[model samples]
Structures are given as C-alpha cells and as structure tokens.
Target: MTQPKVTLVVSPRERFSYTRASLESIYANTDYPFDLVFVDVCSPESVQTYLKATSQSFKILRTDHYLSPNQARNVGLRYVLDHTDSQYVVFIENDVVVKRGWLTRLVNCAAETNASVVGPLTCIGNPAHQVIHNAGGQCYIKTDFKNGQARRRIKQSAYLTGRAVADVRDQLHRTPCDYVEFHCMLVRTDTFAMTGLLDEGMLATREHIDFCFMVAQTGGEIYNEREAVVTTDTLGLASNKAGLMARFGQLKLPDFQWSDLPYFMLRWSDRWDRASLDHLRQKWNLAEDKYFTKRYAGLGSRRHELLIQPIVQYLTFGKGSPWLEKLLISLERPFNNYWFNRYAQRFEQS
Candidate 1:
C-alpha cells in the first residue's frame, strides 16, 4: 500500500522565538517525511525571513489579516487543502517544542485506530513538574470563583484526580477522550471534508473542543496516543491570550469574577447569558453523560453542587454570593477534589 502524504501545519501566534525552536524540534524529532507549511498572521519579520530562507523543503505563507488563531489555522489548512495532495494534516502550535517520535506515534495511531484525530500527551509548565497541559481532560464549564479569585478544581484521569500533569502521564495507556488539543493533532484530510475546518467565529477559545464534538458527531473517534509525548512549554494553550482579552476591552486578572472566562461558557450552559448550549446539545445530542457529566462528580452533591452556584451566578451575575458562602466553598474544595478525582475515573474509561 502507498503511504499517505502528510502536511505539517504551524501557525505561530505572537513571538517567533518559540516558532524557530518549535520548527527545529519538528525537523529533528519527526521520523517520517512531511511537507511543512507555516502560516503567520503578523508574526515577526525575522521569523518569516528565517523560515523562507532556511528551508527549501517548507513554504511559509504570511498574511497581514491578524485573524484569530482558529481563523488563522483554517487559513493555513485552506492552503493545505488547495496546494498539497496530503492525506493527513497535522497542526502544531509555534510555541510547542516536540519530543522525538511524537509525529510518528500520532500518524501510526490514526492509521491503527482509524481515528479521525490523534494527538500526543502534551506536557506543559516546567518540564520537571509538568501538567497534562492540553491533553483532553473532563470537558466542562468552570465557575466557582471567590471574591474575584479562582478556585481549585478536579478533572478526569486514570488516577481520577489529575491535580498535575504527572497524574496524566503516570499511567500510560491509549484512551478515548472528550477532546484533544489541536496543538499537535493529526487528522485525516477527509475528516475536514466531512466536518469542515475550525469554526472561525470562536476566535480564541473552545474551537478545539468544538471541533472534537464535530468529529465525534461525524463518526470520528478522537484518541490520545499515550506513548507519543510532546514536551511543550504550553500545555496546548493559545498564546497571546492577554492580547486577546485586551482587544475585547477586557482585562484578565485575579479579580475573583473573571469577565473573560464567560466568553467560553457562551457555547454551553443556559445559566450564562451568551450561551448556545441548547443548540450544541441538540447538535451533538449531548446530555448529562459524556459531556459535563464527568465534571459533575465530586466530593458531594453532583448535580446540585454543579448547577447551584452557576444558577446563582446566572441569576445575579457575580453579586449574589455572600463572602461566608465563598469561604465555605474554599474550605470545601479539598474534599471536592478528592471526590471528583475518585469518581471521574469512570468517565476516562467511558
């Protein structure tokens, strides 16, 4: 059988310093041959010049549109669809430095499982003490801030209590996940032909999550290749987040009630004003299970604990909750994490 052609796509957000490092890592670590394409939306001239001059093997497409990361990705992918006869397209962020065998593993997994999307386990933060970063955890809406401060929460993992990245890497096995961050995901080109590209309107957040749902809805299973580890400083997070918030005239701070986070919740939960959850729920036939169902598990009070505060905040926007109640919430988190991690293991297996 003929090997399928592959195109590696990279669209750097802000700094090119990381882009150079990331590109070098890809060329060094990737075991298979691939056509490389870099899409830049207002990246530094030095980075562009370097890429254009350095590699005759790859092509750099630079546009001044300054589009959102998702839009920029679609733009890059549009080029891939038009120019390359690639059977597979992989998107790796400019900020990530990949590990050896990362690309091979993703490609093999996709071929083996016939997975629509397969991504490596991303390690973010300090290399020594990394977190699962963007390797899909329990997908849910985050609420419960206290006096303009964020609260600790638990996500689904094997240990069921993935407090850190090690928790994810500790038990290495392939598992079906709700979503895989696009930072380093391999997708069959036909998947796009079916579900289309990233939703350009999402701008900054939830685009990948939305894409996962789209793929899954289209009979595509998204999986994590636990053996393929990508050591990225960012756990698949969008760069220039500060600039994004600034553009919206919103400042992100520890101001207890993050005015910025709700932008993400808009796609989920009727509790939030700008929600499209009903439409999404209908689109995917989503319900209490396989969505936020895992996130609802915790130390105590699953549905009640999950919805009560969100309901209050929705009814009152951030003014309704009392400080004493906030204190109680803070005190309750340890136990909550304990229960969430313990119960969430079921979701990981599902």
Candidate 2:
C-alpha cells in the first residue's frame, strides 16, 4: 500500500533548550517517511548552530524576532501549503519526543477513520512513557442565562491527567474527542480549507483549544489515536529544579538556560496571557465568569513557578520561603513587563 505523504512542522513550545533532544527523538523513533519543516524564532546561538548543522536533513525556517506559538505554527503551515502537496501536516512542538511507530499509528488512524485531525497519547516528565499529560479531552463553550444576560464560558478538560499510563493503557483506543493538544497533533492538510491558518491572536495560551474548537465548528472529525505516543519533557510539576533534583539520576532534565529567559518570559508574560484571553473571549463571545477570573488572577503563575521559583530555590539554598519567592517575583514583574513591551515594539517595527 502506498503511504500518504506527511509533512511534520515543528515549532518552539516554550523553550529552545530541548531542541536537540526533541529533534533527535523524532528522527530516531519515527520509522515512517515524512518531510520536516522546523520553525526557529529567535532561538539562542547554540540552538541556531545545531539547526544550521542539521539543515541539510530538513527545511529550517528562521525568524530574527520571537513569535508566539501559534504564529510559529502558522509560519510553517503556510510554507507547507504553498510549497508542498503533502496530504497530512503534523504540528509537533520542539519539546516533544516521539516513540517508535508513533507517526505510523497516527497516519493509520486518520486513514481508517477519515479523521480530519489525530493526536497521540501524550505523556510528560521522566520515565517518559509512564506518566500521562493528556490522553484526549473536552474543549467547548458553554452558555448560561442569568439576569437576562447570556453568560458563555469556555470549558476544557483533560482525560486521566497525571495518571500512570499503565493504569489506563487498556482503556485507551482511537476515539473521537472534543480536542487534543498541539504538543503533537496530525492535521489533514485539506482541513485548512475550512479552518484557515492558526489564529495568531492566541498568543500565549489556549491556542490548541481554540484551533480544535474551530475544527469542530467546521465539521471536522478529531480522533485520539492511543497507539501513537509522544512525551514532552517540560510540563506539569516535573519541570522545575526540585523535580530535577528528585529524579537526578534519570535522564538529564532539559535545561532552561539563562538566555532563554527573554523569550520564555515574553511567551508567558501577563500581557500576552491577558491579550490571548481577551481575544479568545471576544472571538467566541465567552463570558467573564469564574473560569476567566481564575485565569486572570493567575496570569503570571507559569513564569513564577517555572522561572522565579527555580532562581529563588537556588538563591535560598533550596530553602526558599514563600515570602521570599513572592518578593522576588514582585521585584521581577516590572522587568518582565518591560521586556514584553519592548518585544511587542520590535514586532511592530518589523
């Protein structure tokens, strides 16, 4: 049987430190033939050198300025659409590692089910195959009427989050799901005819849910292919220094270099998060309820936990107090805002 032509477009997730491992894993594990288009947006010199060295093996798209996750994906997606006649385009983040037969399974599932999109069982952290990050889930807008006001809320849920993969292995199968994450997703190229390019307005978060919602709205079928598996090394509670220390003897944790701070900070900045949330709400007419309020309150939580806590722990000799961490984060918040604003200016100028 002839295999369908697949083009895998890899874009940065949150950091550039995992580029080597993630790219190597894809080439090492995936047996099926596919074209690769890597989008590199302002990655550090080390990562740039690595991609340069490997350029002959795949197409590398570089940008001098940093781009949001969806923007990067769209950069590669547009290239694929304009240049290639591939049937399927898989959007895989730069931090994800694939297992053997992963691509084959995703292709087979899409072929068998005629699924417009397919996602694998994505696991997280060390012992990469054991812990579940997301095994398909729900994402939709819900509406409630109160005081003659129609309140619309965006509802999202991940199945079996943090569960051991072994525990739910038997229950897993290729099935329809409301949404799957962009950490690793196989999308039929023709589906773009209906959904168009990824919405760049989803700058910092919820881009996956927004894209999946758009697909569903366009009568596209999305499936979760259980047999195909991939793991992201930088999610959940396991990405911090303490988590790394706890699992020290295992595989070396992907480093979040000091240079990664600028892009990382801007990527999860409060301004970007608020902008993304506001855009999503306005685009979908979602109401500002508890869901949105909670998100608004925790806009800086990701940068705090991932960037600040690690520095605090190092400075306090692993005994960083909550107050000290909070104080440090307070001191750092302005710098983050400045950096993001500067970045936005640069983007606008470009």
Candidate 3:
C-alpha cells in the first residue's frame, strides 16, 4: 500500500520544539515511508536555519510573506497536491508532541473509516500526564456582558470524550461537530478540492471550526480518535483570549450586578477599553474602583479568576440575590486567600 504523505505547516512567530519531536517520532514509529512537507509562513532567519537543519530529509517550502495560518494552510494544500501522490495528508502544528503510534493510529482510522477529516486528542498547557487541554472539537457559547464587557464561559467540548475510537466497527462514521482542532487532523487531498480550502477570513480564530463545519455540510465525516494523543503547546492561549475580545466589542450591563463580572472578565481583554472600566464603576456604583488595581493585588493576573466570578456567584446564589453579592464583597478576603493558596505558584511563575 502507498503510504500517506503528511504536511506540517509552521507559521512565522511561533516556536517549533515539540513539533519537531513529534515529526521525528512519526519518522521513527511509522512502519511505512511518508513524505513530510513544511510550509514556512513569514519565518525568521533563525527559524529558517532550524527548519533547514531539522527537516533536511523532508521537502521544505517557504512563502515570502506571512499568510495568516489559514492562508498558509491553503498554500500548503496546493503544494501537497502538486508534489505527492499519497492518499492522505495530515495537518499539524509546530508546538505539539505526538504519542507513540500516533501517526499509525490516525492513518489506520482514516483508512478503515475513510473519513474525510479525522482529529485526534489535541491537549495543550501541561502535557506529559495528558491532562486534556481540549479534545475533538469545541463550541463557543457567547453571552451578553452587561457593563461593556464580553465573556466566554465554559466552551462545549461537544464530541468524543475519553473513549478511544476503536476499529471501523466502532467509528462514529458521521458525527456532528462544530469544528475540529487543526493542530492534529487528517484529510484526503480530494476533500480540499471538493469542499474548498479553509476560510481565510476567520484567520486565527474559528478557522478550524469553519473547515470542519464545511466538511460536515458537504457529506463528509469527522471523527475524534481519543487514542491518538497529541500534546500542543498553548503558549498562544493568552493571545487567543486577547484576540476574541478585540474582535467582539464590549457587552453592556448595569453596574455592580452579578452578570457584570462575566463580561468584565472577558479574558483580560477588558484592559483595552477605558469604557469597560467606566462601566465597572457606573454599574457597581463603586468609587474609583479600577480593574487593574484589583487584578494586580495578587500575582500574575487575577484576571481569569475575576472573569469566573459570575459563574461562582451563580453557583452560590442561584438567582437574583442582592444579599449574595454583598456577601461576596464581604468575603472577598477569604476568597482571595483560598484561591491564592491553591494557585499561588502558577501565578507567581507567570
């Protein structure tokens, strides 16, 4: 059987340690030979040297300008079709490490199921022990933020959980997913031609989701292979949080209300808008209470904790309870202490 060719694209301004390890692991573990393609998007001189040094055995191509990840990906798709006759192409990211047998598992899943797109476990942050950063696909649940703030609560992981995708018999065959993470996914070359390349407009955010959505709409299957674990470095999560807030304007809410916090904590994006700070004061009816002042009280940024305040309030207060809000205000010290004890090390390190 002809082994499937794989294309791993590395964007400019991104680190490439774990990904190199992953590719090296693939080269060592796979039973058959596979072509590796590297699409360099606005890579720096240092990165170029590293890529040339590391990827000597594989085909490497570089673009002059930075084509946002989605655009770079389309360029890669074109390269793959033109150069390789392999049956499948796997799109992977730079800062990821794959588990042993990861490639064979994904390809085997693709062969047995013939899925147009197949995704494996793409966990981020702390890897090794495999604490899930995210699995399968994700859903964005947007809510109204009262004081010129926008908030993102717990996103829906939606598809496959812990259960591994067995053989063809156990394949979901066709599962409805909002989007699959591009960090680790497989696609047939024809699928790109048939459904079209990723929507470059979405760019950094929601591009993968849009791609998977398109695939599903066009009668293709998307599967989550829990067994094929890949760990991604989430060094970009902070930037991703900033990007979401920048794209969406602030949510307007009345002052000092429980819902206000959900918006204010919009992943630290609230720092950009002075109006959001004004909203915080006007709604809470407080005197000159600044978000930054509160944020830096602890280590790192109390930003994330502050964002989830509404969720905690909801869990504690149930519904409309003026008294609960007041109680939270009074118990602020204890609450801070509890959280500090739990997360002090991470924040200090950050």
Candidate 4:
C-alpha cells in the first residue's frame, strides 16, 4: 500500500508546550510522509525564530497581521490546496499534539471507512485518568435557569465526547453529527474543496459546526477514531482575560433562536454555563443573555423584564435556578464579596 501524504496545517500566534511538543511528536513518530505548513498569523517572527533551529520540511507563511481563527484556517487551507498535492490534509490547532501512531491510525480508519473527514480523540491526561475533551462536536442545549436548577440531564457531549467506545459507535451508527472539532480533523482534499473552507462569518466559535453542517448537507461522512488520541495545548492564552473577552464578545448570535441556541450554548458554554463559570471563578459578562433580553424587550415592560430576568439572574450571580434568586437576596453581600475577590484576583493576574 502506498503511504498517504498528509499536510499538517498549524496556525500559531504565541508559543507553548503543545506547540513544540506537536512538532517534535510528528517529526519523531510519523510513519507516512507528510509536510508541515505553519500559518503564523501574529508574531510570525517569533515562530520563525523557533523554526530556524529545526530542519523539518515545513513552509512558514507569515502575515503582517493576525487572522481570526476562521480566516487563518481558510488561509492554511488555500495554501495546502495550492502548494501541496497531498492526498489528505490534517488541521491541528497549534495547541494540539498527535500521539504516537496517531496518523497511521487515522489514515487506516479513513481508508477503510472511506470517510470524507476523520478525527481522533482529544484528551487531557496524567495516566491517573485522562478525561476526554473533544471526541466530536455534539448538540448543545441551552437550559433555562429553572431547568438547570432542577438538575435534569442535558446533552453532555458537544458532539459525542465522554461516552464509552460502544456508545460512540452506537451514536455513529445512528447518524453522523453536525461536524467534529477542527483540531486533529482529517479531510480528503477533494471533499474539502467541494465543501469549501470554513465560514469566516463565525470567525472562531461554531465555525467548525458550520463547516461540518455543510459537509453533511453534501452527504459526506465524518468519523471519530476512538484509538487515536491528540492532546490539546490550550496554551497560556486560554487564561488571558482580554483574549477570552475578544473571542466571546465577537461571537454573533445565530439567525434561528431556539434552533441554534443549543449549539451556541455548547460553543460558548465555557463562558456562559453557570456551573462552568462558578468552578473557574469566571464571569461571562452575560452578553448573550443581555442581547436576547434586549431583543425581546419590546414584549412589554413588566412581561419583558420577567422573560429575560432568568438570564439576568444568571449573569449577576452564577446561578440560574429560581432558588438562586432567593439565595442571592438572602446572601447578597457575602456572594458579592466572594465574587469581588475573585474578580480582583483575575484582574490582578491579567
């Protein structure tokens, strides 16, 4: 069997452990032939400095300015489509590293399954118990404050993440999801060209969902390989307050309200989910709620206020249940003090 040629597209801004680790892992373990394409969106000079020390077969495309995630990906796709004649293109966020034998596993799965797009498991690990992160994108359901407080079960997977291998297989047997995460996604060059690049409108969040939606609309199958693992290098920037705000603030609400709210919540759950925010001592600024609240405010002064207050309640205090309202009124000062300290700590660190 001929070795499949893969082009690895990396969009890097600043550097981190996963950046260097990804390159090193690929250089050391790749059995099939592959070329690396580095899209340096910001501070290409910094990346070039690091690249100077390595002798890998890579093409560094430096831009004077930074491209948003979606744009950078599109740029990388164009470069791969134009420069490399490789059969398959693998898109890995700068922070992700492929495990040993990862490419062999993905390629074998793709060939045998004839899947248009394939992805490996994404996990955070320590051998104690590596928790799965992004196995594939799943439907996101934005629960109401009451619903959340009730502690009802919601769709856990962004697509199909932490389920056992059998559960994942069963879901796949039923229907392919909207799309998998871009990180560690494998695509056939032809299918990629046919579907086209990611939607620049999204910029970052939900872009993958939009892309996958198109691919599935065109009758392409996206597969998740259980055995293959890729580690996501969120880098230090994930903790950056300004970066987080910019990423979340720029997210435009989808056209359909209830239809897309689930996915919207999924993509931005890091910022919007109450449980997630409380755990991190983070504040999402409740922008989404504010938007929806204002949009439907015309319903009536009292009625509109009542309708949107659920979201407001979530924003002000990291709780969404009606019980949280009572809890807030009873313990406002203490809760405020706690959040005040947390806010100060986050700000000071930033």
Candidate 5:
C-alpha cells in the first residue's frame, strides 16, 4: 500500500528555545513518510545554526524579521501549495512534542472519515501525555438582538481541558468537532482554495478559531482523533501553575532567557492583541460585548505576568510586590513598544 503524501509545516509558537527538542521529537516519533517545511522567523543564532545543519533533511525557509503564527503558517502553506503535490498539510508549533503513531493516526482518521481537518488530543506541561490541553470542543457564533440591533459573538469551548488523560481514556474517540488548536492540526491541502490563506491579521490570538470557522463555512468537516496524542512544553511552566493561576490568581513565571524577551514581548503585545480582536470583530460582523471587553482588558496580562513579574520577583527576593511590578512594567512598556514597532516595520518592509 502506498502512503499518503503529506507535508508537515513547523512554525514558532512563541519562543525559540524549544526548537531542537520539538524537531528531534518529530523525527524520532513519526514513522510515517512525509516531507517537512520549517518556517524559521528571526530565531536566535543557535536555533538558526541547528536548522541550517539539518537543512539536508527538510526544506528550511528563513526570514530575518518576526512573523505571527498565522503568517508563518501562510509562508509554509504557500510553498507547499506551489511546489509540492502533498495531499495534506499539518501545521504544528515548534513547542509541541508528538507521541508515537501520532501522524499516522491523524492521516488515518482523515482518510477513513473524509474529515477536512484532523487534530490530535493535545496535552500540556511535563509528563506531557498525561494531562489534556484540549481534546476538541464547540465553536460557533451566537447572535442576539437588543434595542432592535443584531449582535454576533464568537462562542468557543475546549473539552477535557486540564483533565488527566488516564481518567478519561475510555471516553476518548474520533468524533466531529467545531474547533481544534493550532498546537497541532492537519488540513486537506486543497481546502485552502476554499478557506483562503490564514488571516495574517490574527497576530496575537483567535487564529485557530477563525480558521476553523472558515472551514466550517465552506462545509468542511473537522474531527478529533483522540488516539493521536501530543503535548506542548509551555516554556517550562508546570501544568499545575495554569490551574492555580486561573483559580486563585497566582502566577509562576517560566524560564525566559534574555534573548527570548524581544520576540516574546512582541508576540503578546497589547497592540497586536487589540488589532487581532478588532479585525475579528469587524470581519465577522461581531458586536462588541463582554467577551471583547474582557479580552481587551487582559491584553497586557501575559507580558505583565511572564516578563515583568519575573524581574520583580528576582529583585524583591521572591515577594514580587505589586508596586514593584507596576514600576517595572511602566519602565518596560516603552521598550516593548519600541521593539515591537521596529519589528513590525521590518516585517512590513520585508
């Protein structure tokens, strides 16, 4: 039996430090025959060197300027669409590690069920396969009328988020779903013709939801293949930290090296988040409501917690006083703005 032709496009999710681990895992776990196209966007020297040395194994496309996750996917998608006869394209992030038989399971699900898109059971943190990030869930637009005005809003949810995979192992199965994350997803290559290139305007968030919405609009089916498991290493943040942060508003900072500061800041910048949300609102004719309001208000939360809080903690001997956090954030805001603007300009010119 001849194997299906597939192309795997790996792009940066947020940081470059996990590049080697992610790439090595792909080669080690995946026995399926497929081509690889890696999008290297302004990664550090070490990452660049590693990709260069491994260039013989796959196609490496590099850019000196930074790009959003969607933009990076578009770069690889365009290349695959133009140069290769791949029947399917899998867009995986640089930090996601796949388990054995992951790619084969996704391909088999798509082939057997005729799903236009297939996503694995994505887990998070250390002991990567034990806890679930998302198994698949609901995504749709809800419309309401107030004061004789129609308003539309995006409604999304992820199933089994934070649940231990061992507890729900029997409940997992292949089923249709409205949304799957970009952490790892497989799409029929020809489906791009109907959905168009991923919206580059989704610079900070909602890119996955937007893409899935487009696919559904075109009458394409999406499925969750529970047997295909993968986990994301979220910058060394323990899995429990996310739960604690959500429930009690506690934060444990991840390991962010100095070299990662610029890209991390730009990727989670308030400016990009606001722009992406605004674009989604307008493009989908969504009305401004509490969803947008909360999103807008929390735009700087990531940078504040991940970047500023760490410095404050270090200086204050682990106290991380609120006042110190505020002061450092004020001091860092200008630099963040300047660097992101400079990178944006470079991206535009490129």
Candidate 6:
C-alpha cells in the first residue's frame, strides 16, 4: 500500500539557527512521505552551506530576489503543482516545529471535513503549550484610545487571540471558522489551482486574511482541527516582539516595509476612506494595534473625558476589560453580516 503524499513548503531567510531545529523537528516527527520544498531567498553563505551539507533529501529553489512570503509561496506552489503528483500542500513558517501526529491530524481533519483548508492549534514551544497562538480567525477593524493621544486610531485584526482560553480550545474535532491564518495550514492541491494564488501586490501583510476571504467568496469552508497541534516561537507580532526587534538589529537588517492599511482597504474596502476605516472598526470587535501608520494616527487624541459626548465608542468596545459593556454594543452588527461579503461582488476570486 502506498502512503499518502504531502508537499511541505518553508522559507528560511531571516533566522538560521532556529530554522535548523525547525527542519529537524519536521524530519523527526512527520510519519508520511512528503516532498519538502524550500525557497532560498538571499540566505547568508553559512546558512546555505548548512542546508547543502544536510543529510536530508529535499529540493531547493534558489533566488537572489527578495520574495515576500506571498510571492515565494507562489513560486513553490507552482513548482509542486507542475512537477509533482502530491495532492496536499502544507505551508509552515520557519520559526515553528511540529510534533508526532501533527501532520496526521491535519490530514485526517481535511479528509473527514472535506474542507478546502485545515489548520492546527498552534502553541508556543516545541513541546507545545496550552496557550493557543493561532486558530480559526476572522479579519476585523478596530479603534482604541491611548495615553498622549488626541483622537482614536483605526486598526485591523483577527478577532480571537491571546492565551487560549479553555472554552475556545475545548473541542473534540475540527470546527468551522471565518478563515484560518497561515502559520500552519494543510490545503487541498486544488485550492490554489482553483481559487488562484495570494495577491502579489499586497506583499506579506494580511495575505492570509485576504486568501480566506477569497475562499469564502468561492463558497468554501475553512476548518480548524483542535487536535492537530504545532508550536511557534512568536505570537503573531506582539508576544515575542522585543526579541524580534533585537534580532533585526543584531542581524543589521534594513528597514522593514509594512502595507496592511492601504493594501487591505484597497482590496476589500467599500469606500477606502476614513469613514470606511472607522465604520469597520466599529463593526468588528478588534483590539490593539497590529499595524499603525501615519494615516491612521487619528485626530491626535487620547483617553480623556471618555464618557463625555463625542468619545470614541471604540474606547470601551474591544477585547479588553468592561466585558458586559463591550459585549452589549458589539452585537449591534449581526454575526452573519461579514463586511467581506459586501465586496465579494467586486473582489476578484480568480
């Protein structure tokens, strides 16, 4: 009997040491035959030497161009689809490790649920932890008040995060979600061929969100398998951010370019204006600032006379304290009223 085939893609350009362990963990734990694909983008000589010296059997696509995750993914996916007969593609970031049976659960869930995409419960270490790092999530716009600021600023986010609460993680099987982030994802071979690849114009930011939105537009469901687990080193951006900054400085990396705001608005916004940003912030129960910019700096305001008239409702309406108050007003928008759907008509699926 032939074992089922899986193709895994990983890009390692930033951290060399961590990626070595990441590769070892996969080779050590995975139980199935997988065609491992690595896109080498301007990796240092030492890193390249290490990869070449490895005993592991894998294929490497070499390039000098700086391909964002979004672009590199396309290069590898096209290669897999065109050169191999694998029926599944798994995309995992470099700083993560998978344990025994992790791949099994992801494959099993995708098979049983017939989902277009199946992702696992991501924890915070190689041994894994209770705190859920990433799961089934949705795109949301938010506003918040801060010290030394005049007016609230608008931001976009995924609705659920933080230490995985018991209720959210208490599940026997896969669950449906608006979309699943790409930290670790197992997708059907046809998902890309059918729906097309991530938008190159958007670069690395919010491409997963946009991809999920695109999946929804095609009437496909994304599932999160609770049992399948992987471990990550960073929590999106906030948790291990200080360490990340130190790495950037240590590596003497150049400035980083982020394009979540205008790119997302241009892709999904109904108006792509301040009103749309503010309305989306109120519509979605998002909190915190993932990607702040000069344009989103707001009316130069802060938390003062909040109860006073003209206060930003966002002050009390987010994933923070004052649960009852936030919950009551949060229901103003119906649950099924996904803002992405409004743009489904104009958004390009293919």
Tens-digit lDDT string for candidate 2 (35-137) = 9999999899999999999999999999988899999999999999999999999999998988999999999999999999999999988768788888899
Q: Write the per-residue lDDT of candidate 5 for residues 1-350, one digit (tens) a residue.
A: 87889999999988888888899999999989989999999899988999999889999999878888999999999999999999999999999999999999999999999899999999988877989988999989999889998889878778899899989989789979999999999999999999999999999898888899999999999999999999996565563243222225444344444677678888888788889999999989998888889898787777776666665665666665888888887887787788878887876887
For each candidate in turn, the TM-score is 0.61, 0.94, 0.56, 0.58, 0.91, 0.62
What TM-score would candidate 2 get against the native? 0.94
lDDT for each residue of candidate 3 in 230-266, tens digit (9 for 90 to 100):
7665433422332222114443111122322222222
Clashing pairs in 1: 131-165, 132-165, 148-255, 148-256, 148-257, 149-256, 160-341
Stretches of candidate 6 exceeding 4 Å from the true structure = 1-3, 125-127, 139-160, 164-169, 234-350
Residue 90, model 6: lDDT of: 91
In model 3, the clashing pairs are 146-252, 146-253, 147-253, 148-251, 149-251, 255-283, 255-284, 256-283, 256-284
By descending TM-score, how would the candidates be arranged? 2, 5, 6, 1, 4, 3
What value of lDDT does candidate 1 attain over all alpha carbons?
0.61
Q: What residue runs in model 2 are displaced by over 4 Å at the alpha carbon?
A: 234-254
Residue 138's lDDT within candidate 3 is 60
- Model 1 TM-score, all chains together: 0.61
RMSD of each: 14.0, 3.2, 15.3, 14.1, 4.3, 13.7
lDDT of each: 0.61, 0.88, 0.54, 0.56, 0.87, 0.59
Best by TM-score: 2
lDDT of 4 by residue, 139-233 (tens): 43344555445321113246445544444554432224445777678888889767777765554344565567567767888887757777663
As for candidate 6, its clashing pairs are 149-301, 149-302, 150-300, 150-301, 150-302, 151-300, 151-301
Best by lDDT: 2
Worst 10 residues of 2 by lDDT: 244-253
Ranking by lDDT: 2, 5, 1, 6, 4, 3
Residues 287-343, candidate 1, lDDT per residue (tens digit)?
A: 433434333333223222333354344444445566544655665555445544443
Instruction: Score residue 274 of candidate 6 by CA lDDT.
Output: 37
- Judging by TM-score, tell me the better candidate of 2 and 3: 2
After aligning candidate 6 to the native by TM-score, how far in Å is the CA of 157 from where it should be?
Answer: 7.4
